[model samples]
Every structure is written in structure tokens, then in C-alpha cells.
Target: MKSLLLSVSITASLLLSPLVSAKDITPIQKKQLTEISGLLRDNPELINPLHSNLKQYLDGQKSLETILKTNHDYLYNNPQQPYFGAENPKLTIINFTDYNCPYCKRLESGLVGVIKKYPEIRVVNVLLPFQQRMIPGLKTNTAWYALNVWENDHSKFAEVHRLMMAKPSRHDSSSIMKIAELTKTQKDLTPNQKKMALVEKNEQIFSQLGLRGTPSLIIGNEIIPGFIPQEDLEKMIAKQL
Candidate 1:
């Protein structure tokens, strides 16, 4: 029974593959599909979970589409959001990131490459501190500090951003403050209420989009969740361009 179920699962995945269409179905795959159909007929319960999951996925996608469409200008053109790249960009990519997220850190280099390669592209950085619960220091966290720097001095924000992203591990309040000092943005170390409010707004947007993790990118109405290699990142950017 275990083997049968595994086979059915594998066959179902193959059926769902983009490369395998009805017209392109091979003989063996057709046989497996027939067997899967038989199994599903015998056990209707198996389809329930799959159906529920599919419905949930479709609902999330629809929600994301609506949010992106409604907040298009805010996501791409918000002056408050700290960004790196062309001052007047032909294209924009909204990056949702968390300082404590390793994947977000990994994505930084690829994102930098994209910015360099595409001179007309602007990458707006939205600091979404999803990992705040796990990390110490709520008010003076890295995300909040970065936002504070951006709000106070736009010129120094870039260096602060770079220093934070360059950290090998998760940043605590102390490390975040050190970055601010290094970048000469340590004068106003006190947590600003306005910055906190902006971070809260970003959290709301993140939840509305149904984003499960950090390192999500919004490019040309498409939300790509998680880290992608430089090559794939370039391809997606090219499509947007």
C-alpha cells in the first residue's frame, strides 16, 4: 500500500509538471495516470487533502494579485522606502527582506548584481522584520535602525544598509548600532516612533500578500518568494525590462 501510494504521488506530480501536457503524455505516463485514477476512485479521501491544498494555493495567489494591483504605486514609488539603483528607474523591483533571515542575506549579492547589470532598474528595499520574535531587542533592531537612518539621512542609509547586509550572522541591537556608528548615523540611536510605524505598515503589507518567508521580490506584478540564483534573477529582471 505504501509503494502504491508513493507511485500515485509521483505520477500525480508528473501530471502537474509544465513540460508534460495532455498531448505530450507518454505511454507509460498514461498507464500510470490510469492507475492513479483507479486508486482515486477506490479511495476518494485522498483527493480531499489535494483539493484543499490547491484551493488554498489558488486563494493565496488571488489575494497576492489583488494586493499587488491595488498597491502598485505605493510598493514601487514610495519615497520613504530606501532603495539602491537608478534614481529615475525604467523598472522597479520591491524587495521584502528580514535582517535575521539567512536566505535574505544570500539574496543580497544576486540582487546587487542585478542592480549593477541593469542600470535602469531600481530595487526598493522594504525591511520586513519577520524574525523579530526570535531575535533580541525589539525597538532597536536592525530593521528599525535601518529605517531610522533612511528617514533621517538618505545619503547614509545606503552605507548602513550595506554594513547590515554584509554581516555573516543575524544582527542584534548592539551590532545594528555599531553599523550605524560606522556609517556616522549613530547620533539618533533612540528608536523613532515614526520608523516603528512604517515598519508596522510594512508588516501589514507583508501579511496581506500572504508571504510566508523573507527574501521575497516583487517585479512587474509577480511576487517571487525566496532566494533565486543570479542567472534566474537576471532572467526574471530581463522579462520585466
Candidate 2:
């Protein structure tokens, strides 16, 4: 009985492993899975914990969906949010990004491609600088600087945003301020209470949605967390359209 329980636990863990996919399973593994499935059927109580955990996860996801729906206007249509794409778009997706996150950097090109392909879609940029810290000379935060540039001068925001995103390493106050200077957004880089408030608001919304990390996206009613490939992104957008 003890050995049987151990096998069940191992099999369950293996089944749940992200590294193990259907195509990777061998014939012997398939036979083992079949045997495990039979065991699970016979001893239904063995799976109660797994079932309960899965139910909890699904419930949490549903709750997040509700939150997203509730805050739809503030997230997608707020005038304060900096966005790129069509001036008047049929679809709008919100991006929760951190300047220092490499995954967010990787996802940037994909997002740009999506925008180019779907001229009627808009992507709102929500700066959540989780990894940034205050530098001595810079009066404001890196993300806050970007937000300020966007608000004060919309024309320079794109170049400022691009320079920051293109940095090979994490952005410091100096690097960000240099980009601001280069783009002539330095004048607006002074600390602004309103931009700080907007950044805080974005963080609050990110928390409300239960997002774990940067590069998360909101497409339609679905809240996609983490980096998504351009091809898959297009597919998701197509479905929405």
C-alpha cells in the first residue's frame, strides 16, 4: 500500500510537470500513464487534493477576469494611459510592462508587429517599474520619467520609450535621463506628482488583476500573463476581431 501511494504521487507530479508534453511521452510512459489513470479511477480519494487545488486555481482566474471586466474603462480607454497604434482603434489591449524586464523587451517587437498588422488595434502601455530604484541625481523614477514624457509631450514619448526599451541592460536613472535629454524630454523629467500618481494607479490595477510579473497583457476579456510569441499574439488578436 505504501509503495502504491508513492507511485501515485510520483505519477501525479510527472503528469503535472511543464517539461513533460504529450509528444515527449514514450510508449512505456504511455503504458505507465494508463496504469496510473486506472489506479486513480479506483482510488478517487487519492486525487482529492489535486482536484481541490485545480478548483482553487480556476476560481482565482475567474475572479481576475471579473476584475479585468470591472476596470475595463480605466485600463483601456483612459486618456492618461500612453498608447501606440491607430488613433481610433476597434480593439485596445493593455500592456503591463517593466522597463528592466528582458521578457518585456522581447515582447515589444511582437507587439509592434501586431499593431502594424492590425491597424485598427491600439496597445496601451502601463509602466510598472518593478525592478527600478531611485538614483541620486534623478529626481524621479525611470518609469515615472517615461510617464511624464508621455503626458507632457506626446511627440517625444515614442523615441524616449524606444531608447529605454532598447537598452541591453537594466535602466538606471542616468541611462533613462540620457534618453530624455537626447529626445529633448529632459525638461519635463522633473518630478511631477501627477505622473507619480498615475504610476501608482497602474501598480494598483496590476495588483487587482493578480498579475505575478511584467509583460502581462489584457486582450479582450482574457488576461494573459508573461511573454507571448508574435504568431500566437496575432492568433489571439484575430480571434478577438
Candidate 3:
């Protein structure tokens, strides 16, 4: 027993050795980080930082193991999952995004390639309900108008979303006009007065979610705030497959 214990200790130390980074990471490590982020909900200890006294299921589990047991809410009540990938494929990715978020735009840039890699994957998006609240005043109203149009006609939403992301302005008139042309909701869109009213309604739903910022993500069961590495996400998704 004594001999066996000594051998295991040696193995653990070697594996846990510090991961050195010159600029703090190698190109490969940097890349791995992108795809390695996973939902570790089932492994309760992960949430230990947030929840004290949580039991550890780690049991010498490697720092990076395919997390098999994320909370059901992570999968069931996901903010995004634009489509379904439950059974069709194991690689499913959801981005909980706001149109105005810079990080969300950054993530969007990498999304096209990720989708191409896994044809069977489902990349659903959960519209962050309160995205417009970041901007104040009439701009907020215009923001709501855009969202309403997208929600009312989802088929053309992807285009509208891209248009909103293209520019830096938040709920401005020029932006609204551009989106209107793309979605062509000019006549059907709520009048300016109605748009303002609509935004107020949307703000309530956002507040209820407890979302504090834009570009927040519900990757698997992992709640990653702001910009994240795509490679780490890729690895997490690949394991499921």
C-alpha cells in the first residue's frame, strides 16, 4: 500500500506541473484554450467558487476531462440553441449574445468556420432580451424595433443581426434605417412612438434574467462572461461527439 501511494503521488505532481507561458501561452496552448472551455455542472466542485461546501467528484480527475454531467438546465433551458443538436450530433454550441456587444461580434467572426467544420452541429442563438438597455433614450427604442422585427420574422433575422453588428453605433437613427432596409420592416415596423414603448417592455424581460452584461455566454453549462477563445470551445464540443 505504501509503495502504491508513492507512485500515484509522483504521477499527480508531474501532471499538475505549472504550465509556463512566455507571453503567457504558446500558439497551440492559446488555441487549445479556445476549444477547452466546457460545462462542468455535473462535477459540482467546479462551482465551488460560487457555492461553498460543495463535494468534490474530481477524485484525481485530470484537470481536462470530457465533462459528461452538466446541469440539465445548461442543456434544456439554454439561452441559445437556435436549432436542435440534442441527438443528431454531440457538437452543439450556443451563443447568448446581444447585438451591440463587441465581444459578441468577435465571436461571430469565428462562428462561420466552426459551423463549416462540423456540418452536423447546431449553433443556436438565444436573443439576449435586454440588449438595447445598454443604450439610453430614443436609440433604445430603435434597438427594440430591430429586435421586434427579427423576432417577428426570424427567417430574415440573421441578416438583420449581421447588419446591427457591422456598425458601432447603439440604437441610432442611421443604424435603424440600415437595418430597416435590410429587414425591410420600414412600413411594418412599429412607428417611432411604438418602438420606444416596445423597448420598455423588452427591458423588463432582460432584468428578470439577471443578466448584467452583454456578450455573456452559456457555453454548455459554463457561464463564460465576455469574449472567449473559440479553440477552447471547439475542444469542448468535439468531446461530446
Candidate 4:
């Protein structure tokens, strides 16, 4: 254990060195950090500093990975996915969110604000309701409702999304359906077969990406998880562009 701590300290030092940038951490170091993160997950004492360094390294490396591994055709070009903003956008942000997540709601507002400011950015919103630990089954209904609305009439999506996020109510099917009715999207989904299938597909996509949780975003090659300020989001977009 002492040897392990020494190794992590050494790696952390390298990350902090004046000459060593995020890109300087080679593939081997990434693997090492990843392993250490997993091993230290149960050790609360050592996890904080280790995770901080790991996050720094990951932030630097994700852009490069995005360039190499991003499936633009699947994420950006797919006609079936719902997106908003400039038709011809300089940057695209693939956002994974859940209606049940407070952080997702916060991020949603931030994203909308940013989009309004920078009309050249496009946002592809993906629903992953089950990602929230606070509310489990309720996410299915909200995700289905949102997707149903998008599938039926994308023109109404923006309004429906805002309503769904804005309505202060408990996370449940009844509340979700009420919001849908208010948004005039209740009729868009019934029998729940097609919409539920699409919801499942979205869930699968989220899982396949190995995303950590709601409010996660794919901006270019960088995977940003959790709620980030609108200003920071703009900066990330600017960096990509």
C-alpha cells in the first residue's frame, strides 16, 4: 500500500510539474491512473487527491480521444436524434440528462442560456432518466414523454422540454403526463410501445458510452460530467471551435 501511494504521489507530481502538461501523461500513465482510481474507490482517505489528479489527466486526454473515437455520423449526423440551434453549427454538444436529476435541470438552463447567446452551437439532448439515483422508475415515464414529443413534432420539442424542466413537481408518471398534456404532447404517445422502445435505445446508448451520470456532456472530444457553469460551457465550446 505504501508503494502504491508513492506511485500515485509520483504521478501526481508529474502532473503538477511545470514542464508536464495533461497531454504528457502517456497511455500507460492513463491506464495506471484508471486502475488506481478503481482501487481507491473504497478507500475514502486517499480517493480525493487521487481523483482530482485523475480528473485533470482525463480532461486533457478526452479531447484527443474524441478526435480519434468520436462517431460523428452516429451522434451528429443521425436524422432520428433531436437537436436544436444553428442548422449549420460550428460545434455540437451531445448532452445526456434525466428529468429526475436536479443537476440536469440546472445544466439544461445553462445550456439554453448559452445556446441563446451563441446561436451557432447545436445541442443534441439525450434522455437517460434511470441514471438518477433519487428517482428510479419515474425517469422512464419522463424520458418516454420527452422522446415521444420529439418524435411526433420536433417543432414543439423546445417548448415541451422547457415545460418539463420548469414545472416544479414530483418526479412521477402522473406529473409527467400532466406536463405532457399542458405542452399538448399527451396525445403524441399512447400504448407506449414505440416511445418506450426509443427510451430503451437511449438508455442503451448512455450505458454504452460508459457515462458516469446525468448532466454529462460530449463537447467535441471532451466528456464533461456534472453541472458546469454556463460561462465554463461557453469556454469549452470556444476551445473546440
The model with the greatest TM-score is 2
lDDT of 4 by residue, 1-241 (tens): 6677667756765555543568768888788767766767756677666667666666645644554255567667766667888899988899888877788888888898888988999998877657432233444456666676787877788888887787554466666666667777767645367666666777766666666688889887567878899999989888778
lDDT of 3 by residue, 148-204 (tens): 665566577667767766776455666666677767776535535544544443344
Arrange candidates, best TM-score first.
2, 1, 4, 3
lDDT of 1 by residue, 1-241 (tens): 6565555665676465543458878798788778878888998767866555545555555676778778777778787788889999988889999878889889999989988999899999899877764236534766777777887877887777878888878777678667766788876466777877888888889888877889998887567888889999999889768
Clashing pairs in 4: none
Which has the higher TM-score value, candidate number 1 or candidate number 2? Answer: 2
Which lDDT values do the candidates have, in the order given?
Answer: 0.78, 0.82, 0.51, 0.71
Off by over 4 Å in 2: 1-41, 46-51
1 versus 4: better TM-score goes to: 1
- TM-score for each of the candidates: 0.74, 0.77, 0.53, 0.68
Stretches of candidate 3 above 4 Å error?
1-89, 129-131, 134-143, 191-211
Q: TM-score for model 2?
A: 0.77
Q: For candidate 1, what is the lDDT?
A: 0.78
Poorest lDDT segment (10 consecutive residues) of candidate 3: 50-59
Error of 1 at 68 (Å): 1.3
